[model samples]
Target: MTELRGEALYWEAFERLKSGKAQIIDTNSPSFKFTKDNVAIEAGKKKGFVKQERYPDLCDSIENTENTRCSAASRDPENSDSIKLITSQKKKANARYSKLKAEHDLCLEKMMNLLRENFELRRELQELKKSSMQ
Candidate 1:
């Protein structure tokens, strides 16, 4: 029996997790955030198996996967504060709306300035034509 190393080891761990063959250790609840140590343990290896310096890709993949899982969990009503999240989202939406409104006003002001310039140019052209006719 040969022991796995590097990418192969992390791949095996992820497979086990996906297949429900292994469970994350040391987590008291489902809401617990996974760490490198958890991945190591899940792979049936020591907590030191996941080294950031040596296995950066594995670590990055684990972090990305965990973030996705956490975000999904956050949307679950039992796992997060729904009212607080809604309030924060609303605040962000209002801030975006205010920014867009300011940009629209600035564009409108520029359009008005251009229209005034066009009017002045037309008035000057009319005066030139009258002088030339005289």
Candidate 2:
């Protein structure tokens, strides 16, 4: 699709909205809903939550998709190779998460220790001050 910037984009959107080619969802609208399923899948198909989300626009695009206009992933959403790619990526992601979790837990333990030490030092300082006054 042609990319429109600045006033062109605004005017195009305003015209489309005026002509009823698009829809605007208001807060009190009966169709207004928020769920994890509705979240954008920029993270790819590794997210099962996103797969269950019903997007009318996706179905429309898939049905009307042109080879020239379609993205690489859009070419074949149900391909076996795509599934293999997703599985491989998911495994790598899980490994990275485990590593990060270990590091986070270690850092948290260090923070807790430092806090306890600070409390102990403050208590000792108060006791020393009292002793000096006496």
Candidate 3:
């Protein structure tokens, strides 16, 4: 079987996380957690494979899943301090996600502009070559 790479590997790990197929062995509690290192391990990779700079969409999905899990955990009243901590973490995750999303958009725009410029330069070069040949 061919080994998965790039977006495929990332998405596969995410699917495992979302579907509870990834093993939850390391946690002190049995609760399943959504972490980048876990997802990387799930994808048969070393830690830090799910980088925001490399895979923003996958990172965003993982963050959303983690936030949802935290929200559910926050509903438990047994530990008010834990609930407050989870809420705070959720807020921070959201803010970070927003910032990353903005940065990703700006990067995409810059990439598109560069691609257009490259194409135009190539076309101009071809025209000049043809004129010189004629």
Please count the clashing residue pairs in each candidate, in the order shown: 0, 0, 0
TM-score of 2: 0.43
Poorest stretch of ten by lDDT in candidate 3: 23-32
- All candidates' TM-scores? 0.47, 0.43, 0.48
Query: What value of lDDT does candidate 1 attain over all alpha carbons?
Result: 0.76
Model 1 segments more than 4 A misplaced: 1-4, 23-28, 81-134
Q: Considering lDDT, where higher is better, how would the candidates rank from best to worst?
A: 3, 1, 2
- Find the candidate with the highest TM-score and give its number: 3
**Roughly what TM-score does model 1 have, to 2 decimal places?**
0.47
Model 1 C-alpha lDDT per residue in residues 1-134, reported as the tens digit of each score:
34456668777776566455666553544434556777788877788878889678778877887898788877787656755676789999999999999999999999999999999999999999999999
- Each prediction's whole-model lDDT (CA): 0.76, 0.49, 0.79
- The better-scoring model by lDDT among 1 and 3 is 3
Indicate the residue-level lDDT of 76 in model 3: 63
Ranking by TM-score: 3, 1, 2
Q: After superposition, how far is residue 1 of candidate 2 from its true place, in Å?
A: 42
Q: Per-residue lDDT of 1-134 in model 3, one digit per residue for the tens?
A: 44446778768867867776665324434345788878888777888877998777778888999999788767767656765777899999999999999999999999999999999999999999999999
* Residue 43 displacement in candidate 3 (angstroms): 0.4
